[model samples]
Target: MGQRMKPFIILFLNLLLCQSILAPPPPVDYGDSELSLKDVEQLLELYDYEDGLTIDEPQVEIGTLSPIRHKAAIPEPEHTNIFSAEHELPPQKPLPRLPLPPDALGPQTQRGLPTCLLCTCLITTVYCDDLKLEYVPPLPKNTTHFYGRYNKIKRINKNDFANLNKLKKIDVTASQIAEVDEDAFRELPHLEELVIRENQLRQLPELPSTMTLIDASDNKLGRTAIKNEAFKDMDNLQYLYLADNKLDHIPVPLPHSLRALHLQNNNIQEMHEDTFCNSKDMSYIRKGLEDIRLDGNPINLSKTPNAYMCLLRLPTGRLI
Candidate 1:
């Protein structure tokens, strides 16, 4: 080898070693949760260099391809792009029309008339309240309840509720009823409630054996208004409200099933020994008579000690 060329070869080898040491390392790939520029700067600041050599933050290329991210598969929506033309939603379907209800009564009947309001509740209840009628409206065959309050009904004929076996409730409040035929309510096999409060009725109709409640308060049910053995057939009678009446005495032999009896504001002055309790049965205890209101009556309640012997609670009346 020529002696002059030896210096040039040594210089060339030294330049190659310097170039290798100064070259930058390859960029690291980060996944989906890649750090931002600030995160990288903080990481660089926290790093303790063994060689004590300071490193400048690497300038990331704007258009470089990011690292491939691995994640769980997600389900696509039904209408992902609702407004997009190709992925647009289909036209909405029109709702089906509902059929009209069956008109049980023919067009000639009194249904939908101005005299009564048909209640769509159980059993097509008929409300004849405030109608100012003199007689009961001809009800449908399947009426469960009849409300004829604030009317001018003077009498209840036998044909009023002739074949209404399904009739359960009859409310003729404040209707100025003067008479009820002996057979007006005798045939209602399922009759439950009879409300004739605030009326001019002198006597109540003969009720069926199926009566559960009877509210004849504020009426003219004088001493003989209630029939002889008025409640003898009502074995299921629970509540009897004859308050605000001219009843000089309680209807005798109240059924054993009576729970509440409201005879307040009456003209009752005394009670027989067997009216509520029997003088014969001392061992009997009338526990079902939990509530009995006679507070506004003319009778002093202390005088009727023997009458209330079988009651669970004494009737409320003027004690003094």
Candidate 2:
């Protein structure tokens, strides 16, 4: 029995060995195949050759990206307002046809100058006085004198008389004006007389060197209002009215060219010896300041006799 089983076992062992030897070898792991430095150089050379090909040659048939397209521009919207049309102010209509004047009826009116029912043929002098106007009216180009008194004008803007080159005089008295721009009348080259009286002006505006007369009364003007040597430069100044204001003392050493000074009702309590006359010599008189009104003040004329010695008359104030 041992001899017969040995041959069968040997045969089976041989068959297994033969099958193992005959079978194909297992596959090897050839991970991601990386190109070597030399292979990369060869690939670049091939690309260069392809790029150098002529237009008719198909170098390396490849697809292309689509071109970019720009969006269309939007149009501007129509004029719109947050406020309703009914609530907004209506467009100001043009003036109705005016009657014929002695001058060229249509041509004179076409000057675009404002018309006053009360104004006469003399258009140069626009007299809108005492008409209870709240604002100053636009004047003509050739206007020389303009009067807009007893109105409710609160402020004097710089653009009030902007380009009126021929304008010479402007009187806006008793108009309840509280504010005045510093350059309101500074640009005018020919402005000689300026009357802004009986208003609420606290600080006086810069006076033009060409100014000859300035009337600022019935308002508030204190000590610091008049800059030191304020009126010294005005060589041609003659009449200066500063009555019924808040001045504490007389603007002493007043300009020699000053003719009339209406400081009647102010806060002036005293006047220096050189206020009107030269202190070194009392005989020296101030003939130009003859029309001085110092009434309604706290100072006494009798106390400062030397102060008014050169003057023709004394100031009208309490003397104790």
Best TM-score among the predictions, by candidate number: 1
**lDDT, candidates in the order shown:** 0.76, 0.73
lDDT string for model 1 (1-320, tens) is 34454444334435434544787423323566654435544553565333333322222348968876987788886765546787777999999987744544311224445223332224558776776778887776777888888889889899887787899999898898888888898888899999988888887778888999999988888888887788976889999999888888888778999999998887888878888887898988998988999887778878768888888787777888
Candidate 1: misplaced stretches above 4 Å? Answer: 1-103, 106-123
Residue 35 alpha-carbon offset, candidate 1, angstroms: 56
Clash pairs detected, candidate 2:
none
Query: Which lDDT value does model 1 have at 97?
Result: 84
**Weakest 10 consecutive residues, lDDT, candidate 1?**
51-60
What lDDT is reached at residue 244 by model 1?
86
Q: After the best TM-score superposition of candidate 1, give how far the Cα of residue 245 lies from its true spot, in angstroms.
A: 0.9
Clash totals, every prediction: 0, 0
Task: lDDT for model 1, please.
Answer: 0.76
TM-score, predicted candidate 1 vs. hidden true structure = 0.64
Q: What's the TM-score of each model vs. the native?
A: 0.64, 0.60
TM-score for candidate 2, residues paired by index: 0.60
Deviating ranges (above 4 Å) for candidate 2: 1-121, 281-283
In Å, residue 313's CA in model 1 sits off its true spot by: 1.0
Clashes of 1: 0
